[model samples]
Structures are given as C-alpha cells and as structure tokens.
Target: MLELVKKNIHMNRWKTQVDTQVTLDDDFIVPDTMSDIAQVILDSGEVQLEPARVQSEKVTIRGKLDFHVLYRKEEGGLQTLGGLIPFEEMVNVPGLEERDYVSVSWKMEDLNAGIINSRKLSIQAVVTLEVRVEALFDTEAAVALGALQKEDDGSGELTFPQIATKTRAVNAAAIALRRKDTYRVKEEMTLSGSKPAIGRILWMEMRLSGALARPLDGKIRLEGTLLVFLIYEGEGESETVQWLEESIPFSGEVEMAGAVEEMIPAIDLRLVHKSIEEKPDYDGEMRELALDAVIELDIRLYEEQPLEILSDMYGVNRELTVETGEACFDQILTRNAGKCKISEKIQLSGGQRVLQFCHSSGLVKLDQAEAGEDMLSLDGVLEVKLLYLTDDDSCPIQSVTELLPFHYDAEAPGITKDSVWYLEQGVEQLTAVMAGGDIVEIKAVLLLEVLVLQPVCQSVILQAQTSPLDRRKLKEAPGIVGYVVQEKDSLWDIAKRFRTTAEHVMETNGLTSEELHPGDSLILVKEIVR
Candidate 1:
C-alpha cells in the first residue's frame, strides 16, 4: 500500500544571508528623499521534494528522495531550474540538520533509470537569496542675489541692502552588477516655492536616477521645478505706498551624460516625482524641501530725496553806467563825418532808456528831446554806426558797427542815409551770429512766383535728294557700335549705354573670353555720326 502527504511552504519566511563587507573609499552623504537607489530582486520558482519509503528486512523506514536541479539566470533577476536526479544513483544526500536550516543538492539523470517504482521523491519549495549590490550617485550644489538699493534718488545714496539665494542637486545612480538587473524604485522628491516681495531666497532642486553602486556612466535626463522669489522694496512716507507686491517664477531643464559633480543655478533637473513646501517667517518667507529651497527677502528704506542744485554765477557783470564828459562828447562828434548834434540840451529816455550808440562811418544826432512827467523822449538819426543794447541796461555798447545805413560813393566820401534798410529779398542769404561768436553763412535761394517764358523749337529744313528721312530715324538707328573685347566691358552696361542689344555687344566684343581689365576699353559710337 502507498500513502501521500501534502505540506504547505511559506515562501515569505525564507531569508538568504550574504555575509560580505563592502567598503566605499569615501563617505556617502545620503541625499535627501531626492536620492535614488538601484537594486534588483530575483524569483526562484517552487522547488519539489519527494517523500519515499524504503522497506528492508532489518527495519521498516522511509527515506526522502532527492532530485537533480539546474538553475539559469534570466531577465529581470529570474532563475530557471531543469533536469532531475534519481534516488538510486545519488552518492550523498544533503539533509536538514535543524528545522531552521535546509541543504539542497542534485545530480544529472541517466537513461538507465528512466522509470522507478515508488523510489524517487519530489518536493516543492520556495527559494529566497540575498546578494551584495552597490549603486553610484552624483551630487551637485548652486546660489543668486538681488539688486542693490540706495538711500537717495541721486547716484550716491545709503540704504539697506537685500539678496536672495537658490540651490539644487541631482542625485542619480548607476547599476554595476555581474548581470543585467531591472527593478522599480520610488521617484525622488523636489521642492520649490516663491519668495516674498521684501525677502530673497537661496533655492535649489536636484534630480536623481540610475543605479547607486558604481559610477554613473550613462545618460541621465535632468528635470525639476524652480523656486522663485521676489525681493521687495520698503514703503515710502505714506501707507498708500505699501501696495501688493508681485513675485516671479522660473523653470528650466538640463541634460547630462556621464559623471557630473557640481551644477549651476537656475538649471532644470529631470525628475520622476516632486513636491513643494512653503515656510513663512516674520521678516521673510522660505520654501524648502529635503532637496530644494527658495529664500524670500524684504528690503527696507528710510527716505530719499532729490539733490539740490548749487548756483555758481559769481563776478558776472549785470549793469553798466556811461558818463559823457566834454572831451569824450567832442571826440565822438568830430569822428562822425556827417554828424548832426542837438543844438539844445537833450535828454534821451522812453522805453526803459536802454540804448548803445555804434558808428561805422557817421554819428547820431539827438535833434530834440522832450521831458514828460515821468519819462524823457529823444529823436535822433543814428548815422555811422548802429548801437544796440538790451532794454534792461543804459550802456552804449556797439552791437553791429557796420550795420548803420551809410554809403561810400566816389562823389561823396562818407554819406549817411536816413532811411532804414530792409531785407526786401534774399532774406535767406542773411548770415546770423552763432552762439559761439562765429558767423554761419546761409545760401540764398529765390523761387519764382510767376510763370516764365517757355522755349519753342521750330522744324529745320534738311536737303534730302531722294526721300524724306523717317521721323523714327533717331529711335531706330543703331546708337553705338563696339568690338567685343574677350575680357572687356560687361554686355549689360555696354549695351545700355549704347542703347543697343547685349547680344550684339557680346558678339562684337568677344569672339571669346568674358573677363576684362582696366587697360581694355570698348568703343561707344553715337547713333548720329555728326
């Protein structure tokens, strides 16, 4: 009689111990939650065990039979077992000395013992093993500042300064295993946020990928969010100046291959997962995470004002007084070739009494003067030189010496005209004194306002013996002719100048080459020989 027993095996309870110490040359700074770790798990399907009972003359006992096993590494950390071993051919059997431990062994099967009657044993069991694995990861760090402030509106101002900071890192791992390994791990966490108007922040974000044991020598796609902040300026005199401030956000990405140590700020990092956390403070606010941070800042100011202008017009002459003595009066009168002086006492006034007497060839005649209740008016003819002065001052300063109405005729040596000279025409031709004390000459252009005479061409009689020449003779005639210099003028310009065909010019000039030089000249004949 044969009997059968069924046993259940708990696969989760099995543990494989790999006792090996692996040392890294440097201390590994375990990155925050953003760091990535590379590892693999293999599955070894159920193993079968058989219970066999062997009957002998001495005693009746049952012995477990063993089976042959073959294992092969497969994709995704999987192993396969093949073949079997017969109980009769087994020289030694690996058994379980204690309930906590079990030893397994197997051998190849031969064709001779193909069939056995209640001799071979097959058992089902689960296998779990632990292997030494290492992963490599790269680390990085980054920072940014805000604009400076001044105390006053002008360049030199004293005010409180503020700045913001940002930093990030990319934690990636590369798998360095004896065989190909594949498994999934949780993605890294990224942190990012905005800063307050008054405060700035130091922000950073990191991206991690690949295995963790060996150096990361593969391409990594870096991606992540940006922590933004707005550095605000302080309020002014009134509370109305304290309005809502705005914050700016930034985001970007970077791609890298092989190993990377340090990363620059404001670079985007590729990541599998990310999270953001916001923290507020009294002076400012900060957004931070295990891998990233953005700092807020508040800039304060006391007061600012415009700079005062300093006046430096010192020692400048503002007024002048003229005293006319007897000798000076007589000298001035004698120098005037055509002088007409006032016979009676004359007082010049009216209109602020600001006047300057200048002479080019004559003198001024204060013929009459009338003194009113509060003003004195004088009539005079300014001869030789014309005097011009601002109405604010009563100084005889010469403005334009040659501007006086005077004439030098052969008959009259120096004669003064009493009439005022007006610029009736050619006003544009007048030159004015520039601010630099130099005369700027201007061109005088006269535009005709009336119609002018038009020229008339009359027909001419030509002595033609046989027939009258066609009126289109000028239009149809070959304007000019020239030989085509193999390397002379271009066919286009040459043809245009002669009003002829480019093909004709090319054929006439060349016979061959298209290049031309300076010494090479082409003949341009007129259509009409005359």
Candidate 2:
C-alpha cells in the first residue's frame, strides 16, 4: 500500500490579451477669456481609465481622452486649452468569465487637433486599449509518501523498510496576490529668485521616471523623480513666454493589506490623472505650482515554495502495482533589466527654422520578445515627439514626430521555447537640441524589463495496490546469490530488483553506505519461505 500527501497550489488558469481602438470626435469653441486660435502648434493627450466590467465572453471599458492643445494666438502669443472626450468600448474575449480578473491599459496611438476656424477647434484621437484577463484556480499535488497500513492476516505494519522509494525536490513560484489600485500624490514647488513669476500659463508637461517599489510590512514604498517643464508669460514688464524646468524627487508609501518582506513583487505603475495649477507663495505672489496626480498600480506577488515528491516506489516483500501521473507547476526563471539608447537626427522641411527647443517626449513600444538558446531578444520602437520654437511669424511653434527602432539582447540562461514572459518598458531620459542648420538631434534612454517563467511537468506516484507474494516463486528462488554492480546502479535498485531490503543487502555486504561503483562485486542473501 502507498500513502500519498498532497498540497494545494494556487495558479493561473487562463490568460489572454486583446486590444481595441476607440475614436473621439469633438468641436470646441474658444472661451471669451482666452484668445482666438491662430495656428495649432502641438497637441498631446492621455487616457483615463475606469474599472472594467466583465461579462460572459465580453469586457466593457469606459474612459476619456484628456487632450491639450497649444495654439498661437492671433495677437502674437501662445495659449493652452484642453478638454475631455469620453468613450466606451466593448471587446469579445473568448474564455473570459464574469468573475475573472481583468486589467485594462491604454495608449494614445494618434491624436490630431486643428483649428476649424479662428474661434473654433476640431479634435480627433485614436486610442488603443489593451485588456488582459486572468483566471486563478487551485490544484492538488501529491507531494510525499507516508506510512502504509498493516493487513489483518497476522502481518506486521508495512513500512519503508519493506518498500523502496525515490524522491526528488520540486520548486514552485506560487501566487500570493494580484490586484490593481490607485495612489494619490500631491506636491508643490515654488519658483526660485532667478525665474519670473507666472502671469499666465502657456503649456506644462510633467513626466515620472525611474520609479521603483519595495514591499515592506503591510505597505509598499515607492520612489521616483517627477520632471516638470513649464512655459509661461512672466509677470514682469516684458510679458514674454519664459520656460523653466524642475526635477522634484517624490517618495511615498501605499497601504497594502497582506504585503510582507521577502515576497517577490512585480508592480507596474503609471500616471492616470494629473492636475497642475498656479498658487500664491508666502509673499502672496503667484510663484508656486501645485501638482496632484493619481497613479495606478498593478501588483503581482509570488512566493517560493520547495517540496519533495515521490518519483518512484516499489514493494520488497509484496507484489505491488504503482500508478503515476504528471503535475504541472509554475517556476520563475529570471527577472532581467537592460537599457537601450537611441540617437537620431531629423531635418526640418517646408521652410521651418528652429528658434529654441521646448520639450521632447517619447514612448517605448515593445513589439516582440523572442527566446532562443539561452538568450532573450527584444524588438521595439521608440516613438518621439519634439516641440520647439520657430522663427516663422505665422507659425511661431512647430512639432515633429519620429520613430526610432531598437533591438536588445539580454542573457537569459535556461530559457526555452515553452517559457512565458512579460515585458515592461518606459522612457527614462529624452533630450532634443539643434545640431546645425535645420537639423535637430534627439536622444533617448529606454528602460527595458522582462520576467520569464517556465512551467514544470513532474511525474508523481498516485496510487499503489499490493498483494501477497507468490508462494511458488518464493519456493523456487535461491537462498544465496551473487550480484555485480553496473553503471548508474544504486544499492536500492539492486535490492528492490532482487526482492530484498537495502538494509539487509548492506548488512550482508558489510557496506557502510548505499554508494556503489561500476564492476563492483556484491553478494545478495535472502531467506526463502514456502
């Protein structure tokens, strides 16, 4: 008889990803307080997502396109205006269920805003939303073997001495938590003496980079730098548009209910919503800028578990029939990070001349990650948009967008074609400057991160049926025998094959351990019963 011990494992059942495009069309009339639009210089936007609702084979996501337009006024100055365009989309996912967990992320693939007239603006945007669904389930794994029961026919209790077994160590990456939440970040900065106070806002751009999160005792500590750039009309006599760039370091802790130390954390964070406004400083002058942002966190935690399972087993004194089956487990291969640098020069056309560089923004798109022999190859493109000041009187500002392709290879030993991976990439640094004539140089540093996982399939003993030994074979067996150790042979294997215990064979051969060498001679002694 065989006694099996089992463990319950929580694992991912099914996961799938799908994307959909959402379009926004709207027209806006200029407010009386703001100047009429002369020429649209640059337009940018971000997506704001709500909680996705899941139904049978379908998911509905609702969000808005928060767009901003910087335009040259008819009176020879720049002004900023923005609004929200709401959208709703439903996508069909084949295996999705109502209770499944879903994560929704979006990017503005294309956004265009032009002046319908001097007093009216036309806005159009195409937003791509990627939805990921995960279903978690539990399974029982036969981990180990325990003591067997005795027969009622005046026989002793069965034990390991009467049977032989082999075991192997198994490692697993068990899921601890999968959740999505939001954290609020509020910060304020005052302008220095070298910079002028704000008369009116023209354009503002804020970016978060180099963010890291650590799991502590029931909380998560996050640290990063917020880059803020502002172009505003100064309150001085000139009333000219002056630019100021500031880097603010932010640190905060988010409350997580069951987080603890030493748990592997793969948390992704992004800016979901943000607000920037001018405020009065201590001297009652509008010299301070207040920033409030909402950051969305997608958290995944895994714990390492080690277990010993019976690989093979057999009876020594009884006829046993053993059954085995395979068990699937998830194990972590590696967590890798690398950087890719992109440098490109773009030439201006249509009689455009660069007066000054305003801002540069980039997005890293990971198109594919292919695994080869002991290596992980990454392919992606860096989409960069450059905004600058122009010398032309009609169009004082112009923007350029370019795509820079990048390929990176990271060392991922022991990776195979059957492995699963997840990638997270972002732009760490970006800069734009005039190289000469009408040529502009753009450089960016991209951070690439990947997590690889391999599924393990192990055969384990499921059940064992035992019966009394055959009396005829026992009578016909020799009382003493001679054996020779072969290559890759163990004392346990010799004993089990000869229907004897390892301890008995070791005692007969005066062996202190079960170690054996090839071509070694040994004597097997067994007492025959009839």
Candidate 3:
C-alpha cells in the first residue's frame, strides 16, 4: 500500500454582483423655526448598510439613505434640511447556505431631490450591492510513496526508502482571517480667534484619506487623516455664511483574535456615520466643534504556504497504477495601484456669475472592467459636485454637478475573464477655480487600486493501486533492447514503460541532461526483482 498526504485549501466558492434601486419617496416637513423653501440648490445622499443575514439561496440586506437638501428660503436666505429613509432588499443567490461565509458591499449610484410643496420635499436614490462567498476543503495528493517494511533495529519501526520517493514544491495562499468590525473616532477642535463664532452649523462633510491597516499580535493598527469641511452662520451682527476646513490626524487599534505580523492584510474602510456640532467655549461663546465619526472595516488576511507533492511514482518489483483527479487553487496575481487626472471647464448658463468657489466633492462610478492580452481596461465616470457663491443677490449660494468619463489600462500580464478581482475607487486632491465670469475650472486626481486573484486548475494524484507482478509476462519480456526517443517523451515515462528505474537508464546511457530530442538513441536495462 502507498501512503498518501493531503492539505486543506481555503478559496472562493461563488461570487456575483447584484444591482438594485430603492426609491425613497416621502414628504419632508420643514421645521417651524426655518423658513419655507423657494428654490433648491443642492441635494446629496449617503448609504449605510446593516449586518446582512445569509440564508438558503438568499441574502437579506437592510439599510438607510441619509440625505441633505440646501434650498433658498422664500423669505430670502439659504437654509438646510436633512432626513433619513429606510430600505430593505432581498437578493437571490443560488447555492448559498447558512454555514457559508458571505461578504456584502454596496455603493450609491445616484440621488435625486425635488420640491413637492413649500412645506414638503421629495427624495429618491439608487444603490448597487455586490456579494461574494468563500469555502474550505481538502485536497489529497501523493507527496511520497514507498512500501512499509520493518527496520533492522530492535525498535522495529517502519521506514521509507529515501531514493524510492520524490516530491516537487507547489506554492498556495491560505486564508488566515476574515472578519468585520467598527471603530468610532471622537475629537474636538477650537476655532482660532480670527474666525467668527458659529451661530448654527448649516452643512458639514468628512472624508477619510490615506487610510491603512497593519497587523500586530492580536490587533490591527489603523491610521488615517480626516478632511473636515463645514459652513455655518455667523453669530455676530454680520450674519454672513462662513466656512472652515481642517485636516485632523487620527490613529487607533482594534482587537483581532488571530491576527499576526507576518500575514498579508486587505482592509476596506468606510465612514458610515459622522457629525459636527457646535459647543460653547470658555468665554461662553460657540467657537468649538465636536466631531464624531463611525468607520466600518471589512478585513481579510492570507498566508502563503509551500506544499511538497509527489509528481510521479513507480515500483521495480510490484506493478503500480496511479489515480489522478482535477483540483483548483486560488493564487495571488498582483496588487496594483494607479491614478487618473481629470481637468474640465463648466460654462454657467441662465446669467449666473461665479463670485467665489467654496468646495468640491467627487465620486467614482465604475461602468466596465475587462482583461485583455496583457492589461486590464477600466471604464468609469467621475461625478463631481461643486458649490460656490453666485453674484446674484437673490440666490447668492449655488451648486452644480458634472460627470467626467475616464478610461485607464493597468499592466496585468496574465489576467483572464475568469479572474476574481476588485478595483477600489476614490477621489483625491480636488480643486475648483473660476477662469472667467461664467467659466468654472475643475481639476481632480482620481485614485484607483485593484487586486487580482486567479484560479489555477491542476491534476493531482488521489490514490495508488498495487498488484503483484505476473511471472509469465516477465519471462516473455526482453532483458535488453535499443530504444529510440520520440517527440515529447520523458525519461520517467520511457523507463516506466520498459519496467525499469529512471536512474538505471540514465547511468546506462551516460546522459548528462533530461532534455530528449527526436531520433536520439538510448540503451535500456531491465531491473531484477528479488
């Protein structure tokens, strides 16, 4: 009997992307203290996903759309209104089970806000969700093969012959950790004396930049900078709209049960909730701001493992037959990062003149991604939102949105259509300026990162069947003969066919290399069995 060795591999089982749209049509009532709406200026939205539930053949996703609206009051100034709309969706996924681990990710494609009445507002948004499943199983291969025999020592231990078995090294990536967690950042900052005190906060936004996670012993260290922007109403008699921008550095650590420094980490970070509120300073004036942010993290780690497996085996005395089957493994292809630069000009219509550029935000939406002969082609659109001050007295604050299309090709030598991959998209270094009375110049650098994993299929030995050699057949076989090397013939294959060991054939023929050419003559010698 031949001994067999096996190893367990963790890999992706099934993956799919589902695009669904949820409409949140509800009336938002204006507060009594705020004035009625006359004209809407800007509307934006953000999505927050709840803990997903995985069942047989389906996944239940629940979330809410948090939206903000900036409108000109009928009484003559700018006011803000905000609300939340809840949504639930059921995604149909075949071959999914409760015990399987599922990963869910989502993005907001578009959001539209309209006015229904002076006291009410209408809001709607579209979202897309992606799902991936993973599993673990064992693969059996003949790493070493030898007949068991008692040792000559008195201990009587069975030992394997070193020259009878051979092995080759194969590398694979194994999963070490897959988990999800959240972290909250609480900070406070006081405004400089030169800046005016805030009466009320009108609009605020926070973005996480240069975020990274590193693994340690039983923990993961997180570090990033927060880009904070806000516009508020002044408390003094000036009563003008003032804005402030700040970059705050933050760092923290999260506990991961089995994380280690040697593992490779792939982390996804998102800001699920954020808020900036006004607080009174030591002088009893509202000059300080309190910042609270919630970030959700989806983390995965992989460890590279080298496996030694038996490629082929044969017996000199006994007849041996090897059984093989197909197996698949997920191999890491590459982790690449690239950037695209976008520059465009917007011509304002309806007699609108730009007095000052306030702020700009960008979001990247991927439309297509395909793998070519030696590259990965990506097609996407960058949605930019611009806010500025207009020269018009009636509507001093104005906002506009523009879509810029971009195409980028990354160098990926061996990528294919069946490859498992993902591209992480973001915006960085966004700037907007006025070129002329009606032309607004916009420039932004869009960041793109991709990770590719390819599945490799190979034939592996499953088991070995052995039987005693027939004496009559051995007697009829020739003891020595001249052999001609054919095309694509290996020394192991030729030796096994002639009932001899490869070492004996090489020693008898005095060959220096295993490279065999057509019409090459070789001498064969049969092995004698005891």
- Total backbone collisions for each predicted model: 66, 0, 1
Off by over 4 Å in 2: 25-35, 153-161, 236-238, 321-323, 463-467, 476-498, 501-530
Q: Which of the two candidates, 1 or 2, achieves a greater lDDT against the reference?
A: 2
Candidate 3: clashing residue pairs, number: 1
Each prediction's whole-model lDDT (CA) = 0.23, 0.81, 0.78
Model 3, 1-530: lDDT tens digits are 45666676765433455556565667778888889999998887887779788877888989888889888889786789998998888888887777777877777777888888898888877777777776655444556554564222112333332223446677666677888899899999898888889987888889887677778889999998888988888897847888888988899999999999997776788888898889999998999999999888888777766778776776566666778787777677777888889888888776877788888787788899999876789998888888888788988888888988889887777899888776666786788888877887888887777777777777777877555666678878888989999998988888878877777888899988777888999999777744
The per-residue C-alpha lDDT of model 3 at residue 33 equals: 82
Among these predictions, the greatest lDDT belongs to: 2
* Per-model TM-score versus the true fold: 0.15, 0.88, 0.92
Q: Using alpha carbons, what is the TM-score of model 2?
A: 0.88
Per-residue lDDT of model 1, residues 155-242, tens digit only: 2434332111112221111111112222222222222323123222212122231111211223222222232222112223211101
TM-score of 1: 0.15
Worst-scoring 10-residue span by lDDT in model 2: 152-161
Better of 2 and 3 by lDDT: 2
Give the deviation of candidate 2 from the true structure as CA RMSD.
3.3
Task: Give candidates' CA RMSD values in order.
Answer: 53.0, 3.3, 3.3
> In model 3, which runs have C-alpha deviations exceeding 4 angstroms?
12-14, 136-142, 150-168
